[model samples]
Target: MSPSSSHSPSPLNPSTHPWRFTWETLAHIPTLRLYLFRSPTPTALSGASASASLQTDRSLLFVSLTYQSGDVVRLEVPVPRVLIEPDEEVQCVVRSDHVEIKLSLVLPVDHPVVIQYRAAMGFSGDENSVPISLNDDLKSLSSGDVNLYCKSCSTKLTKEPLRHILQMPSLNWRDVAENWFGNCCCSFGAAAEPGFSFEILSGPMYKSAVPNVDSCNCHDNAEGPEEVAHTSDMHDLNHTTSNCIVSNDPDRSNRQNLYFGGGFVHNDTNISKDVEWVEFCCEKCSSPLGSYPYWKDRGNTGTIDGGVRLFKCYISTSTPVGGSDDVFRNYTVQNLFSNLLLESAEDEVSFRTVVRDLKSRKPMLQLVLLSSKAWYMSGTCIENHATGPDCQVELQPVVKVLFSDCSNSSEADIRLVENWSTKCHAEEVYMMTYEIEELKNSLSFGKQSMPLSCNLLQGMHLSWLNSHGF
Candidate 1:
């Protein structure tokens, strides 16, 4: 099908801005969504309207809109397959608001509709889908001793090469265990382990993977937390295990920290009481590197102590090369968080996430992933018209999300939080306050670039993050 009453062209003008564009292929039917934002003051572009057309081969699609003032907007985008030509086959819907135009495209079908739709929308098949995980540079340990330095100033933070590295489970490992094994701990032929329960805490709380203090002790003059088991046969555990870490020697404890998610953790004994946690900073630049808990909590396993968790984004690793250092590539906060959220979503089977401050455990941001496999094209109307005939639209991969800042949530948001908590539909992720602020700023900037009409969906604000290679 083609647009009705197609206009040839006049000198282009900036009457409308299609600030937000999305190409979707997840469903059996492929579709396109666009929002054209109009100015507050009606211009010669009054009575502005739009139309669409497709090339004969359907390799490219054209969109043109005309206003009462005779201004025109013309855009061309590439399609992966031929488009159905009959008017009835194509569905177009347009709605006008106080300051925007909403356009929805439902592509026509052919024999074996699903196949055609997916191909046309550029779904390259399952083999092209890349998996996201924790950053490999820090996740895996190389042969021999590895030294860690501050990414900003190259200030050495570790006294020696890390000897042994262990992986920590997710923050909600206990809940995951309970869900898989049920409330009864006898499933594995043993009672539930002490110092753990599936009950949700009453307010915001930071929970870490901590081992039993009494049983965990370092060997061979190494002051590190020892691995301990609650029972003999608890693989199919119904309760939680004390999977924590501890380190006493300040000189060598740095080599024994465990790596997990996006950070490294070290257990300490001299926790303070005035502040719940202390921010660990780089000695050279004073840049915040991580934090350790100061307050103590009583548990079934006795005084529960927290450990220092060092973020991977703020640090860099190096290996000795001919008595010199070979620094690894720098990482970003966005990439680190993206990997973490993507992995957690797949593991927890939920798209809704609550990012909290690791120290305070206060919810900082709430996000819902709408489409991990998405391509978006965003441009201003002025820029589109200014580009003239040779204008080329470049679609970039992005992870579309609906998000909201929880720093100042409303009653409705509170209710949403309660619902998520009660039903356990949202997974909690932790980061430093500064890192959370950085993520929030990135998302907010993306939202600002979009049209007012497309910046929000449902009650949450909409935004996108650059995909971690899909």
Candidate 2:
């Protein structure tokens, strides 16, 4: 239920709410912060003409403010899950101007040392939030007998269901493992060069050899018998190496291939041998799907040989048997970013990060995680009354963060980012241009709902990025 006040309208009548407020609590923080905003009236009371009362009983915290005009605004917050020490004093600060009335409160510590404020405020996790994981989503998609399509145009992208799905190893898996174990496990062994090896050699063995021809043609007037023999040996070695590389390539194997990892999906099928590179797009709509490598470099994580790497964001899935078509549940831009940030926090063991544009490599936003688990309830306060009193406003789970916009970064901003990168080891997160815009919108909306005092940390804006969604 929304916070209650004596003269405030019911939660069902949100349109007449007279106050704008935000109540927030972070994990492990023993204090609860509540900010209330009300427009100042012509006859508003102040000084000796105004007074406020704060008290806690059982599982509820009650607040009341009385004006000289004999009007009273009261708010009640339910804290059933958090034990409040009613004996302790509560700190309430009120600031008023011709424009608005601002009220702030800091509650004392409860019995539990650490707690999620949302839980205390009577919000159940199951009803309010859904956590999505990238790996889990891919696995679920692979298991379903569905056809993939372009999200924008609904053009069929796959001729058939993906049969074999594999996850690509992390780009810096070895380095991370070594740091933890103090030695490389050698899981993939010393075969770092997966498909082929190209070597450059200089000597008399190539002095008489002609360049730019398919075969190494040697001049008869060039060298002695020993030099000629060396040249012959080099040519054979190069030919044998090329043959071995072609045979060892896994993509050439007779397996229906589809692999996903690192926020990308690859499709390998029906490719002609002569087509060395391709820009994958929907044939009917010609919407850009993804691109294929001109040549494969197994050393680079992005280049999967014999396949096109499609961005998951640009594709959709349809399962005819399930009667679900054009479903965009887990694939929304906000959901993807939330999961990525959660995963990155765990993988990098750091809460600070810089979000950059995937194509331009420009810093879009810099984020410092304040709390992985935070809950907040914010809305306008109503004065006009309605009969129904049972309506409730649900709290949302969010990743509380302090962020800075870097699109038009100044010299100070640049230095601040460099400090986080070097001193804090803040990891870098890359996203598409559109995805960045969506994330920025979410952050700004969250910030506006917060109290002015809670909206800034140092020079960065404090905001919330929803951690869970359907």
Candidate 3:
């Protein structure tokens, strides 16, 4: 085969050059780019009959770098079929000529929940940002369409919102529902009436029985009205407590008496049965004054106000009943109601925090009530103003109203006197009363009763029971 003296064509001809390439020439070629993609880890695939159905087919890849010479050559390569498994290492190798490239295929196991959450929220910008992918089965579970569990651990991973529906507090369900619907519909029905109302019964009568100036003793140094007016002009100042300033004044002691009345109404239907009794307490203090049977009068009233019409209506009997001594001493209506509102507002804040925490994937513990104090403070200011010196100077005290914390404690106590006269000027009035004995009989006899609690704030600890008709 000595072709130097022969007319044979060169084996390195252009047409055959591709078959004559050496290993070094092929080694300089660009590296093959391999891309492997698979569905999210099937922790558990719903509708699968058994664990064996969870397995997926192995993927294969091939790449041709160069045309081979007449001499047939075969390269041995090992590829990883599974990227993740228990007690297994992901190892593989690709062989070319005398060189072998070690490859490692590792599937990430700790996928973040935020990735799936964001995706579910309709994010589609970047894959690197989403570290986890939710399967259709899991998505269905979160959407209230189904329930799912993890196959390997048999753990329930998702549930329906209905499971938490019954957890609403008995006392709060009505208000909560009202607020919810208010936000949704932008209008309210008769249920939107204020929770409290009261009317005045009578009067501006003076303490004195006589209308003549001679009947009341004037101080020895006191001047007559004319003299006092002259003195005021000379002094260039007005004295607020001058007794000689009497003008034409009618006798108040001769006027007739007055009366007032009204009560609260609850619209919610769900109420718990475990509430044994309700303690009406002062709105300002936490003291317990008295206890009434739960739901005594689904619409009954209590005569806690003496002759006053202010009565304890909606009552809850199923509340855990303990000895008066066992009750918290300072539970006042004001404090309890304020606290209830505060806690609800706090929950809403915590919900927002939960949403933020989920986004950051960071655990949080401390939750603060942002609006509770503000509301209480505002209420205090208004109450103070209503009972301030200005009001005292304009109105005369008539009948006194004593407020007590219905609980066993002495912490909640309030005193208020009727000082303003009503526009009606009626002396006689009718007030309703819920007989305690009657309420007790109803509970003992298992008769239907109102689920409202007169003592506890309407929102704390009883909403769920109320909504579920406990």
Candidate 4:
């Protein structure tokens, strides 16, 4: 049900028919509500296996509604089932356990064909406002989370807390015991968003220095994407040039030099063997973001845990505060890292995304990483001071940390979620259905909520990923 102006929406027994009295308060626009059974133990979103374990009749159902004028507003609604029907009337009535919530899209859709865009929070349209770089906005922030979304598809990737990420899980853990004890469950609670917050962490990334002659050869040797001429209405960031902010820069925050990272485990079990690095790409577009190394670093965290390398920079439309958004950057401890507290999964490989090896028609397995459940945006602001000629202060977004556990998923039965090209693109798809019969392993069965959805690489995501020139 929609929120009331007098008070927040309270839980009401749907059988009592009290919602009719509150129906007058909701907006006139059409709304879509998704319902999912919340089992006592959290499970992934794939249909069959997850459904088997759930106590359907008794499980609680959380509801999240999205009001789309033109574009799809991807709320953080994680449900085992999604039912979409046109609005006959502005009603979302359901049974008591089948809870329903309503939250409209943040912006008003004026354009005839408005595809949602994930602009930095501070970049709102106000003529008097001075624009700052995303990097500048992030650095001055005290403590908060950042929302990481696909730039091309605007798919709401995740919202995570900066404070919780800065506090624990210092390094990427790789043990099942650690996974069982230290867990982060991504239950949306009354917060109507669909995507998980910090359970499956993602951040803006850059290309790694390591050379991969096969796909992305981006490294120190790689030049940035060509200049992207943006519209005048784009996020104006001329005021945040390094020269301007450097003079007023407070805290001179130490750039984080290292943090935990993860990737799919391949052959070359021994660290001494040639390292097999797991290259990370944008799920939608397939653009190379960074790499998670397969070899554990004995010098840093014990040999089994610290091996993945993350390229943390993605040159955007505007130049960054202190530097031009030109070259790709390697991850520094300042950008990401926390106290060297216990609990990380650097060795355990739970989920897998398989692609085909064109040379031999063999299956190539890539493990996914569980970073931080941190999302920052939607509330960041820049207060321009009238006293000083160009004084500006950055406001931090609200920070929240949620967790997920994928500890029980063994044998990896999650192979059914195929890549975008495999399902959508018929001729371009290289891997036939019969190729990887032996490796059709199901995910480890566990009581965790980390790997909720399998990301597909297709459409705008694929186009943007393949576009190195952009």
Candidate 5:
């Protein structure tokens, strides 16, 4: 998509302004990075709360958004209640574009975050202010005597005026944006395509053959009930054999595959010595976000360390070096990793299957084997064949069908507009048509019998897939 769609505002100046009077001041605050963000459940290991895991030694204040054009304006009030909602998204207006930015509500907002509402989106006229008397009710911002309420909702938010962590000067969003354009050579080559842009918050940072979070699948059924009981007893005999096989947190599967999906930039300077992984934070907000595996940990395939480059998410956050009239277009992990994802399909495990196990407190690796396949299908039926003048044929599925099988005996059916587009780019219109299969392997927690099945069925567009060497 053209970065300069009507959805995004045009370059503003004395005339082509997306916003004029109220938000014109924001053109001065510089570019603020808005990571494609969404909230998810925290892992038990991280004390699993809804918060960013930033670990900065220096007193830095920021996470990854850089500016390329225009300016930013600091709202005197605390971070508005509107930006904090998962359902409600906020955008930052830079140059001519108004792109969506993330709000890290779970992370402690130490001070006031700039209200770019007027900037990202234009004002709704004079109807936006509070009913309270501005002259009499207004109090000092620094003394903690005043409270800020959301323009959308009246709830009191914070006491800080400007975010405390970083008082650093905001950059010209256009400058950085342009730098990225040249860095990427061209926008498409950089893999920045329009889609839902989000930052990777958790799960494995780097890819490896032998992952620290290893999960296994049980593919065979025990011979009999007595045998099942015996096997269960034998398996229960040691945590090393069973518990580790099942691993923990089935939710991690979804985290690894679906949302926050991005690959690591090799030869990273920020990588930690820890074998399994290292961490990354927003260079702008100081919020700990991404991570990558050490070269040694990834076995033979990884390079040690260098300038870390993130490819799956939006590749360019800065403006072009020589400011191009073009606005920086938003990109997504799906578009960035499209080729690799199609090649990586398997029926090993699906989120729908694991979630059922989560509710039942069952291990996905107990005794199951999974295999999956997907494709586009069409079926034709003539509606009024007998009446030749009124004969017509129609396809039943308006969208594509994602049919999967889990636990051999169990199956799942899903519906979607397209395969490649389903990954965060569009809504999932799905239905679990089949009843979940009861575990035949699960004779008892002490025993095992059935090899469960997981059929991963989402496939790429045949036309696109074929061209990509699928």
Candidate 6:
């Protein structure tokens, strides 16, 4: 009857291993199961034309489930296929030997989806797989200008506008003239009276402010006074603008004093004081009628009276009292030489009688030679043909010849003689052939004379006569 002999074990003393639990009690505890599934529909991968299929056995799904037996379990289940459409739904199913369960699966069709596959890993198992779109953004942002702006930053953009200028062909000279002249009055009118209404003068002529009157002169009542005044005013205005005066009117002599005024008079006197005067003499004859004073001597003789009378002198001034010196000097020299040579030659050869007489007549020839040395010393003839022999010469020095009987010699001979004489100074024999040709053409009948043999001064061995077939 004591407790030590009792068959029942005490619950507090687990060492006796007292109570045993039944299977029904263990089955009543909670347990978890996981499952995976795939849709039967087909799906297309990006950049691929064919529909993609899923492997039912190889495709996997991860699940987190708890069992009623107070245990946690993770399961990987195979999915058959994944369906893709504008909108579609897929579901997962979990089952055991006794009961079945279902849950909705979130497909990537709701947003952008990335499907990826990884090989079996370590103890952690394979990672979750997803579908991805490759190079999607690169294709979308390829072209056109892109403007970028920051949401929270202050930035400035600068804009520039282009300008263009164009010229038109319709513009004319009148526009330019008007722009230049403005409102200035034209030349030629009655002189403006004091207190006359005026405006500022504007034009190329007027440098300073001036009255808008027509002219400074107050000439009255001539013929067409207004026109004449206008013309005169234009002339004066032109003169003032050019800083000089030029006139050709016969009346200019009388009006010279008025035009020149006291300022010009003073200038003229001042200029005259600086000038030196020297007298020129006739290279042939020393005469006073042709003699005049000059500031400078050109050391040459001039012709006068159609070469019949030799004027040995000319006036000179250092100041520019006339036009260009070259023009005047050249004209004087040419006139003097041509007239003196022709006259002196005519006198010596009796050319006037030869021209007047037709029949052959004897000529009294008198040759007067003028040497370059004569200009430095007294211009006396060094060689005189009148005192020399009467025989015809082949070549002679330059001389002024006078013949008392020119009728016997033909004009051809006279021309030949002149050319031969002139060209001989330079030793040019080619001119002799030309003169012979001229003589043959002028004479009624005669054979051409051959040219003289001559040598070049610089190249003495070279003969121009032989080369020219002269």
Per-model C-alpha lDDT, please?
0.46, 0.46, 0.20, 0.23, 0.21, 0.20
The digit string of per-residue lDDT tens for model 4 on 1-470 reads 32321232222212222111000011122332323322222122221111111122322222232212221111122211111222322234333222223323232222222212213333333211122233543343223433333333433333232222221233233232124222211112233222111121223321111111122111121331111111111111111111100011121111111223332112212222322334445556654433433323322221222122223332222233223332222222222211110012222322222344323334343323222121111111111111213222211111111111112224352233234225533121112122222122211111111112211232101000000101
Cα lDDT of model 1 by residue, 93-174, tens digit: 3444212222233442222564355555665432223333333432444345655666667777554355433333344323
TM-scores, all models, native as reference: 0.53, 0.53, 0.13, 0.22, 0.19, 0.12
lDDT for 121 (candidate 5): 53
Please write out the lDDT profile of model 6 over residues 1-470, one tens digit for every residue: 65432532322232232111000000111211121111111111112111112223444333333434333333333322222221222233223211122222333212223123112222111111111111221222122221111111211100111011112111221222224332222221233221111111100000111222233333333332121111211101111221111223343222222211111001122122212222222222322112111122332222110011112112111123222321111112212222333443445632221211111112212122222110000011111111422221111111112222222458785565455345543111111122223222322111011011111122111110100000
The model with the greater lDDT, 1 or 6, is 1
Give lDDT tens digits, candidate 3, residues 1-470: 44322432222232221111101000112222121111111011112111011112322212122213332212211222223233332222222211112122233212334325445655433232221211321232234322222222323222221111112222222233324333222112444321111111111000100011112112222332211110111111111211212122132111111111122111112112321233333232332222222223342232211111112122111122221221111222223222323334445522111101111212211112222211000000111012322110001001111111111223221011011112222111111122222222322221111111211242211111000000
Candidate 4 off by > 4 Å: 1-31, 34-88, 101-273, 276-310, 313-407, 410-470
- Please give the lDDT score at residue 343 for candidate 2: 66
RMSD in Å for all candidates? 12.8, 14.9, 35.0, 23.4, 29.2, 56.7
- If candidate 6 were superposed on the true structure by all CA atoms, what would the RMSD be? 56.7
Measured with C-alpha atoms, the lDDT of residue 95 in candidate 5 is: 24
List where candidate 6 sits over 4 angstroms from the true fold: 1-313, 317-470
> Which residue ranges in model 1 land beyond 4 Å of their true spot?
1-46, 52-62, 74-94, 97-149, 152-275, 295-308, 317-331, 380-397, 410-416
Worst-scoring 10-residue span by lDDT in model 2 = 200-209
lDDT by residue (1-470, candidate 5, tens digit) is 74324233322221222111111001122322221111111001111111121222321112222333433221111122222334433343222122223333432212234234433454332121211121221121122322222221222222222111111121211122223333221132245322111112111122111111123232232431110000111101111221111123333332222211222321122222333333333433332223433334445232122112222122221234112211112122222222223223342222221212212222222111111111111111111111222221110101111222232332222223223223533212111111122222111211111011111223311111101111
Q: Clashing residue pairs, candidate 1?
A: 1-85, 210-244, 211-244, 225-246
**lDDT of prediction 6:** 0.20
Better of 4 and 6 by TM-score: 4
Model 3: residues with Cα > 4 Å off, grouped in runs: 1-267, 271-327, 349-370, 373-470
